[model samples]
Target: MKNDRGNSSGSKSWGMMALFLITGAVLGGILGEFAANSSFLTGVAPYLVKQFPIFDLPPVTVNLYVIKFVLGFALYPNLMSILGIIAAIVLFRRF
Candidate 1:
């Protein structure tokens, strides 16, 4: 009975970790898309402009689609999984 309980608890933890990872991937992809498309970084652009005052300050171009693709395909999933593992380890240690 104790062994069965442990197995069930472990499975539950795994399921929760999977859910967390999926959520993180979706959020990261959305953020990457926003980062790529929006001129939201314009405020920071001036700082770079100041650093290179002599050169013409061209606007920073982020390709939202490319960012979306990369994050969706490569980055987000991996990053989320790693983060989830780290979090699980930390929480387990604390407990």
Candidate 2:
């Protein structure tokens, strides 16, 4: 009924939000990398160079006779990249 329709729309909204977040993260990362290498952007490059979660954590690694697995996680945020995420959130809320 109406409730079901509402639930369907909610799920779609969630999907859209996920897509937006992923897009923002990827775009931000790309910009950060570019800034790091491009001397022209030196003024803003420092902000983009900052890697968040500044501390190191040991990655989980498992090795077996026939297989090996490694899992790692980190959050590195630079100024413009963080702004990108904020912009994404703003867009998400507005839309």
Candidate 3:
């Protein structure tokens, strides 16, 4: 008899994709910075390291009688970082 369980060999969770994307973004940003600073890559610096803010959530504070909380969010992506995200997606699909 065939197995009733779904195929697990090819499936990947969203959490894994998120983790990969975040890691890719961080590494790409770092590489972009290094490229920007490296004299050998001066010509490509302008294309790689310029960050454009896509979202900004200013800090907000909530205070209760006994507790307080602060929250915020921001997204600033550069060209190389965007490329990194794409690369991550490709890698995720391949694996």
Q: For each candidate, give its TM-score against the true structure.
A: 0.34, 0.65, 0.84
Model 1 per-residue lDDT tens digits across residues 9-90: 4344666566655665455445444544559865543332221122344455557875732222223233333444456555
On TM-score, the stronger of 2 and 3 is 3
lDDT tens digits, residue span 30-79, model 3: 88998999999989898899899999999999999699999999999998
Q: Tens digit of lDDT per residue, candidate 2, span 32-73?
A: 888888989888787786867745556899999699988777
Candidate 1 wrongly placed segments (more than 4 Å) = 1-12, 42-95
| Residue 69 alpha-carbon offset, candidate 1, angstroms | 25
Candidate 2 ranges with C-alpha deviation above 4 Å: 1-15, 35-41, 54-56
Q: Flag clash pairs in model 2.
A: 52-76
Weakest lDDT window of 10 consecutive positions for candidate 1: 69-78
Scored against the true structure, residue 36 in model 1 reaches a CA lDDT of 46
* Candidate 3: residue 59 Cα off by (Å): 1.1
lDDT of 1: 0.46
lDDT of each: 0.46, 0.74, 0.88
Cα RMSD (Å) per model?
A: 13.5, 3.5, 3.2
